[model samples]
Target chain A: MKWLPRILGAAMLAGAAGVGIATALEAPAGDPQVVELLSGLNYVPSQSNIDVVLGEGAVEDLIEIAEDSSIDSDPGLRIRAFRSLGQYDGNPQRATAASALRRAIADYGAESSGTKLLYLRASMLSLAAIDGGNAVSNLVTMLGHPSRDIRAACAQALGITGVAAAIQPLRARDLIEPEEQVRLAIADALFLLGSKG
Target chain B: MSVLAATAAMLSLYLASGLACGGAGAGAPCQSHSECDDSYQCLAQVCSPKCTRNSDCGDGFQCNEAGVCNRVFANLGDPCGSEWDCEIGQSCVLEHGDSNDDQKLESSCQEQGEGGRVGSTCIADDDCRDSLCSLGHCSQLCRITDDCPDGNRCESIPRVLGVDDSAFFAGCIEDTSVLSTTIAMSESSGTLRIPVPSSAESFAIVAEVSDKIHLVGVTRVDSPSDFLLFRESDSFEGFLANPIRYARSKEVSTLIFPSNGVQEIEPGVYDVEIEASLPPFGPGTAVPKVSVHYKLRDSHILDLTFYFLNLEDHPCKESMGIDNLDKSSAKNSDVFQDEYLGEIHNIFGYANIVFPEEPEYVNLKRERPDLDGITDEQDLRDLFRLADNEDGLAIFFVRSLPSDGVQTLGTTIPGPPRTPGGPSSGIVVALDSLCYRSWTTLARITAHSMAGQMGLWNNRDPHGITDPIGDSDSSTGNLMYFGEFGGTELSEGQRRVLSLYPGLR
Candidate 1:
């Protein structure tokens, strides 16, 4: 009976070592590829090509890069990661991406207003592409954001969603929107929605 | 008394007699109110009785605020019977019709206003008084060529306003003035508060940092900061710490004010702070030079010089057919030139394209490997430095670009004005895409990049955010639409913005 227990412990130790080796092999291969692709996603023309390289773990990788606020993390890279997440619009794992985007939007900490704005803009577009009708209410709520750029981005995202529910919220915001640029965005959104209908 | 004085006295007496006798009835022609009956008024050179509403005035007339019937003036270029029947500064003139027969002659309001009277330069409509600051000078509104000064013609120019599609006005413009000034920079990183004269309509500032010194950012001094009008950067916070409108490029940083409709840069002394940093490979200290191109007057022609870089040794040359391109001389063949020119003409009817020089073949790839695939921002900057056309936009056509979806068809967002051989000198277009096989696509891409360089933002950015221009929509047909292809039409607002580009001679 004592010899049987010793044999079981030895088997368990071997299993743990195998798992560790598998993780080490996977991390090195996967991380660098993801980082390379993420770095290329900053501008418009290269975005589509990089999306092809993104794999099953891409959503989680993007979430990690987007949420990384460590001293070593590049703010521009994080913003790009947030934007790249939108490329997974039809993926089953998009809900997870959307949730990560939502958390990024809600968690306003030590980041500058401009940085926060960049995050919010990237999140709104991704949410619109990923969630569509489900993202309408959240987008509608952001229409009242204090920043003119944010409000305008939200209005535009609402239009991009192509959801009928977005139209009412946009119209309501149109009445009270004081900023001229925001008003123009709302009008454009309304026009887009009307055309969609 | 002299004969002229006696005649004038008699005419006044006759006019007094006419008024004393309740002279002309309604609808009768009269030069003055004295010729009309008492309680009636002479309006539009016609004797008319007091009226309460437009109905009482009959067709082609409206009751005036003064309780008199007045002839309704026709719009600009509309047919009219008399000067009185047309708007102020407009006159009825008869011209032979297309048939060239006396009987076929038609009369229309030929003169709209005395145009080309004010030669003062202006940047915006608010800069002029009672006249429009169009094409860099105060121009008089006109309906026909007859209203303009000698050598000037009434042109229907696009108007920059948040209005409908038919937003155009006729103005008198003939010549343009392009001027440049050089400011010697004492240091690599310092603020130069250049005094922009009130006479300068639109100006472009080009800062040429030493080869070792990379331009960090160019900030136009302003309160509360409007930094990075074209593209945002992570380093924006540092620039925004001091209130300014910040712009950044590679070796050469160009700042074009009123770059788009969203920005309305008035004519005043602008403090431009040029910031540069020494890259790891660069020298410790460098002297930068700043060149300012001031468009004192407006011009219709957009001069362009196309640089076809020789990609004979490029890695992708054989695959992309770069080796087949004629490298002996500038590819000035009529086949591609005519197509390129035709596309530009079709998009901008008012804009004329002038090739300053035959397209030159530059063996730049032999010197720089980075030119092969412009994947890095520095590579694009290096490619732009190969341009040598200062009087016009320098468009560099390369063999290939990074196939990564993020690779730009054109590198510069809004290319620097009047600068040559610098990072922001001009736009770099990659000819690698299968899309470039169609000359129409290539032309559209060129036109789009030119419009962007000329200060027009995308109708809608990739983030789904629309431009500040109200008239520009998300229509795929709009030339300024964010997509790389399909869009060909330019909105009136966009045309108006493009007219402000300093490169237009």
Candidate 2:
């Protein structure tokens, strides 16, 4: 199926060669979806694309999957694509948000590498805490990471999470940990989690 | 009947929680007066004002002008008369300067699905003690120090996994909050059968129940007749009459019924997937507990008549002319525990292919659940004769030893567990199967069945295998696979026997 990269019919994939690189800029290299998307970038895709490209089942599945971290089982564009979907409203959306975020955090941990990986993991964990209701467990564990940014982020998140349990961890860290600023943040987070441990 | 009246009579609606609630999805709205899942508290003793957090309430919810906690959402500014309007995370506070109706909870929305013993997070094993977070279930139990209830002891529950092994239940030998409960499911399909006390609510699901949702809705699409739920009828005996307390479409939301919130039962006939978030509202929930009962059925071998005995000489008389009824040599098999076919008990399989004189007309219909209107003596005889070619046909007689399935019963809990993974399968039998093509086998079987040839489908799980006959046997040694090169590792005699039959064209 390798053809010259053509965007919207004008040969965006013209440079596409064998099992290697892709010069197509509209999408990432080596991704057939990107190549296909490029080919039709010019052609007016019928509204059927709505149902075909982003079918209802796909949307719902994306929603269901995007909310959880385990769904990152598929290690490719599809996983990242689903994680980027939005949420529902009312009590229903409220209910699905919690574990979905927990899953997202878990999935991010498996995907990331190096220093930036910690940043991404921390960001995702923070995002999970906000989406899910007062999650002290995840937030507290996030504090255990080697990265100070992640620990600080988790400490801050733990405060707003509103679980009284978060206070003990923050206080525990304050007494034992040598880092003064981290201890200070823990003390403040304890105050926010609704208990000054 | 009025909704309330209908709900009251079906009294099971009061069955709170998991043992009953079926599947529900996301993004559906609900009036505070109507609720789903007992997790949401019914303030004022009636269904109203669900407060997951203080932020859900507009402005801020806290201890409002009234003592009840109020709730509020973020960024909408302070707009509330009481604190009860706040959400779970928010705390309603009174304005220091203003005394007139300024009661508001200033707090962020609380996190959802956390802060609990089982489903929530815990720093130490003690916090998670009361809950089991194994195998994707989040229920409270005390199996070990790791699975103990908060402040409880961990002891093994007697015969928890099965009769042979002692599964520990971690809890104080003298602990409280550990409740003993039981639930069951229908045995065969068609007529629902279960054994839950109509009154025991707040119990856990027993392991045996499968494909069982809280409420079961059976509708006859073709027939104009309205579907009826009964308990026990002559034609439709033991049907559920108004099986669900209340039934509704998208319009009619919650039904009014005094809910007890718990039920326990052993085994009996009941509805499937009928429990709803609303009391007896029936069917359709966010989390669906659906089970499936897969079966392969056949008909009764009603009449056995000896037609032609090739004792002297017959078509099946190979080269020489003879037949020996005594040397038929067949051994009755029982539960010998074959590694391949699970534990089969009392299996007697008889297959007969009818042969006729000078190409007589022949036909066959798989006789099972439905034999149609022709249930009389003459009709039954006629059907069998056509199937066996008026008089007799080619056939084989086979029987198997009796065997049991699943080593022991599994740990069955109601509702999705807070703890996701746990080991709870009672039936553990070693099986020697083709692992690589298992999925392909399933797909092929599915395709054949869907194409309306289910009667001819071959089950990968075989009857028995002391190792398929070796090099000399049929190549594939697939008795079920009729027209194929002999299965691998079959006996030469077996292959010769297969060669005697015509191959699949």
Clashes of each: 10, 169
C-alpha positional error of residue B127 in candidate 1 after TM-score superposition, expressed in Å: 32
DockQ of each: 0.03, 0.01
lDDT by residue (tens digit), candidate 1, B94-196: 3323233322224566554344333456654444542355545665555555445455555554333221111334555543466565666667666554434
- What TM-scores do the predictions have? 0.44, 0.19
Stretches of candidate 2 off by over 4 Å are A1-97, A104-112, A115-134, A177-197, B1-505
Cα deviation at A128, candidate 2, in Å, is 4.3
Top candidate, metric lDDT: 1
Weakest 10 consecutive residues, lDDT, candidate 1 chain B?
B158-167
Model 1 - which docking category? incorrect
Question: Global lDDT for candidate 2?
Answer: 0.27
Model 2 in CAPRI terms: which quality? incorrect
Prediction 1 global C-alpha lDDT = 0.56
The parts of candidate 1 lying over 4 Å away from their true place are A1-197, B1-176, B187-191, B223-246, B262-265, B277-287, B311-323, B327-335, B350-375, B404-411, B435-437
Let me know the TM-score candidate 1 reaches against the reference structure.
Answer: 0.44
